[model samples]
Target: MKPLEGLLVLDFSQFLAGPSAALRLGDMGARVIKIERPGTGELNRQLSIKNQMVDGDSMLFHTINRGKESYAANLKDSEDAASVKALIAQADVLIENFRPGTMEKLGFGYDAVKELNSGIVYATVTGYGQEGPWRDKPGQDLLIQSLSGLAWLNGNADQPPVPFGLAVADMFAGAHLVQGILACLVRRGRTGQGGRVEVSLLESALDLQFEVLTTHLNDGGELPQRSAVNNAHAYLGAPYGIYETKNGYLALAMGSVIRLGELLACEALAAYQDPKSWFTQRDEIKQILVDHLQTRTTDEWLQILEPADYWCADVLTWKRLFAHDGFKALGMVQDVGREDGARRLRTTRCPIRINGERLFDTNAAPKVGEHNASIEQEFKLRDAQPSVGQHQPDGGERI
Candidate 1:
């Protein structure tokens, strides 16, 4: 059994950050019930990647919302609101990503929620924090990256600032939210008192740059200098970037340039024997590597580098990586589909492992309000009164 097998999580959030946190708890074996709207449901049901959809919902939504139940309600309506409040009383955790004041306006703020269920782990995700000038700004991943100076850290120095191809702001913020929620849950387990977990894309973005930001803070407030040639990290030195080879690309991490020179037979790299020059003349050193690496194929370089304990690897495309046995060995992918087996989505599985067992769930995402009838029947929500909720753990090997 999974660690969260006894828990009930009410997901009142949409899109990536908040929803992904709920998704994680579900993966850990929580019975996650998504509180969506009546008709259109959450906004992400239509938010598509490559305009891809399966079974009338976006593949993006399928990937994130898989293995969860959905319960649709119009929170503005009194009957629906009261029914939801009943569910809230039963929930071990509650999550939302509405703007700062929205939850309070809806009478579901932390203060109000804790009154009903003092043990509820209230988790919130925002673009910015509740009290800030930027709080009202749309909590978008790109905007967070741009505003947080995260975008300024990518690409070659001459090139424009590049936001990550993936939604790092959303994913990291979600991961951080999970960390906080799990911590609060552990505390509640011991103390029988819950806590609030607040994470913002802006804060998570800044935290992602903690290493480089520390340098900026301590090194006389100097901004990062992106390498003019093949910049990988703004704060890193020579041979720290992905270089093109005869066939493909090779990534070299922090290593002795002299050793690399001897291995790859690039004599030019030997000149910068001074360790400090690795940073000072980084552009020149990198440029030398840029030109010399292309003379040999990536595999050829790997052949020379690997035997001598040099830190290097061949950069592979998704196609090559997926075809590799290394990727196959991880068992990272799984298929989830509807009950009828009419549709199936091949997506990534939960990354966590416990007691040497990998977690796998074949449960697919439910349609909007798909489980409402059953949930109402089980919880007796149609005529819910002010009653204490039940939480029974199907005994588990804690993860």
Candidate 2:
């Protein structure tokens, strides 16, 4: 059985971060139900990547929301609010990414929720923390990256504040939320008292930069210098970036510059014998690599580097990586849906493996309120309107 086999998660948040946390819980066998607006559903339902839509919703939505049910309700509507409150009372977890005070205004804040379901783990995601000047700003990935100084760390030195091509802030925030939620679940298992988990995009983005930020904080507040040439990491020195070869690209990790010089027969690198020069003259050293690495093909460089146990790899695009035996062996991709697997959308499976067993769910994401009737019947939601200020037992009682 999965670790979260019997848990119920109400995903009240839209977009990547909060939905992703709920997705992880669903992967671990929690019964996740997205609480979305009636008719329109989630904002992400129309937020498409490459304008791709699947089964009437964005493929992006399907990617994050697969294997979950949806319950459509307008919180402003009294009957809908009452039903949702009833659901919250029985949920093992409740996740929301509304702006500060929005939940309170809707009567689902931590204090209000605690009264109905004392053991429900409440998770909130925001642009920033609850109390801050940035609390009201949009909780977007790029905005968080830009605001948290993450964008400065990407690309070469000459590039202007380049944000990550991926939604790194959202992804990291979701991962952190999962960590906090799981930790709370562990604590709830012990004390029988559920807790609140608050993760913000800005905070998670800063946490992502902890290593470089720590160096900056203790090293006399020195700002990180991005490498002028082929900068892979803002803090790393030479040979820590991807280089172009005669054919493909090769990624070289941190290693002895002298040893690399001897192996590549590029005598210029031998002049920088002092390890300190690796950082002090990072651009000059990387320039030498840029000029020399392209002298041979990526495969030629890999042939030489691999035998020496050097930290190097031939960079491959998704097409090449997917076809390679190394990628095929991990079985990273899976088709999800009820119909013939060949016809369904292909996506990545849960990365987590328990007892060496991979977690694979084939169910597709639900349409708006697809499971509403069944959920109403099962939970008897129509008759579960608790009185205002009603309090459940302090201990968690999963129904």
lDDT computed for candidate 1: 0.89
In candidate 1, position 24 carries an lDDT of: 95
Global lDDT of each candidate: 0.89, 0.88
Query: Model 2, residue 43: displacement in angstroms?
Result: 0.8
TM per candidate comes to 0.97, 0.96
RMSD of each: 2.0, 2.3
Which runs of model 2 end up more than 4 angstroms from their true locations?
338-343, 387-399
**lDDT tens readout by residue for model 1, 112-216:** 888777778899999999886898999999999999998889988899998999999999999999999999887777667778999999999999999999989
Best by lDDT: 1
Per-residue lDDT of 1-399 in model 2, one digit per residue for the tens? Answer: 888888889999999999999999999888899999999999999999999988778999999999999899999999999999888877888999999999999888999999887777899998899986777888888888888898888889898888888999999999999999988888877777888999999999999988988988999978889998999888788879999999989999999999999889999999999999999999999999999998999999888888999899988999999999999988888888733342378899999998898999888888898889999888888887754433342223432
TM-score winner among the candidates?
A: 1
